[model samples]
Target: MHELQALGKQLVELPAKQLVDIPLSEKTRDAIVAARSFKHGAIRRQLQYIGSLMPKEDEDAIRIMLYKLQQPHKDEVRAFHQLEQWRDQLLLGDQDLLNELAIKFENFDRQHIRQLIRNAKKEQEQNKPPKSARLLFKYLTEMQGK
Candidate 1:
């Protein structure tokens, strides 16, 4: 399995503690951490590399950015397609300008992820059953798949 798919699968299937047991090689785990820790063109590069490892998966990791950023569905999917293109490489012609956009977009993505975690924890706390971390992980992981 490619690192991207493995990480994505882990993000979805494994609980937080179990995620650490997903058996990723150190390099693959490092790559996963790197990709998640920063929002940049590296995400595409990492996806491509992961896809390369798993020849069966040519599909790039599009939702990595979208899910992490918790962006809403805009008028059309093209907006997201274009945004990913901009991040992956400046299809826009200028590198420096795109770098600025990447930074701002990355910041938004980070904030979105933080807010999601906070909201989920808050909701869990108010629930009749009182969600556990494992349950919270399951909810988060499942939602990201969509």
Candidate 2:
């Protein structure tokens, strides 16, 4: 019963697009849609009603699908962090770091990288928008694909 309610609550928290992807019976889907308009006690009751309907569906499969849906977001966050680390290293490290990047990426444009680093440093010193830093990140991402 508690598990059902918990699943119902999770469903309520999902976005409409994702909610559509979950394999739910017509009755359960209608209950979920109706639950969105509910408030306070009524919402709680609707959630309980959804929970009561859970036993007739494949709960495990639904949970696994939700977990799968969330995995790509985690991967994207990991990729973003990796790019940030590389950008920071490029900004702070000496010439050897640039040389290392050049060796790692065959298409690395040394002159352009140096230009961006200089502009980024100037922007930082002036407390301006990090235009060059963003460009450096974009360049790195493009290079990574090649």
Candidate 3:
């Protein structure tokens, strides 16, 4: 299992151009292009929703340094692939791996990450009938105990 703190630190240190790739799955890339082409607010909102799951850390400094590296470019699709490469290089592929690794360093394991990811996805997936922010916040607060 991956150390969440270590992963957080790495994410914080990564350049914005690199971070942009983090959310860029192949499907995400298609959605982004389709969104930009049509100014599709819904797609953009969905992308933003997925992006929201990422820990909002202080990577803004690195992004400022690498600001020019990212733009609405023709190779935006390539960025998606690059992001996938980074995910692989980051070695975040397997839940079991992360859990096993994390246990060596911390008490928490993949089950927690899986739960968090699952809940986040469920939150986004059930967009129409999702829990209110207050309830979500309550759940998140409870998760801290585990």
Candidate 1 stretches with Cα past 4 Å from truth are 1-16, 53-146
Model 2 CA RMSD to the hidden true structure, in angstroms: 2.6
lDDT of 3 by residue, 26-102 (tens): 55334334443344566446445434432343345534434444454436656555434433322334556455445
Q: Rank the candidates by lDDT, best first.
A: 2, 1, 3
Worst 10 residues of 1 by lDDT: 54-63
TM-score of each: 0.27, 0.79, 0.22
> What local lDDT does model 2 show for residue 73?
90
* Candidate 1, 1-146: lDDT as tens digits: 56555645444333345436444445555555555654567666765555444333222443343343333545336554554444333222344644465465433343343444455466656883433333434433343334
Better of 2 and 3 by TM-score: 2
Q: Least accurate stretch of 10 residues (summed lDDT) in model 3?
A: 1-10
RMSD of each: 19.6, 2.6, 19.3
Off by over 4 Å in 2: 94-100
**How does candidate 3 score on lDDT?**
0.44
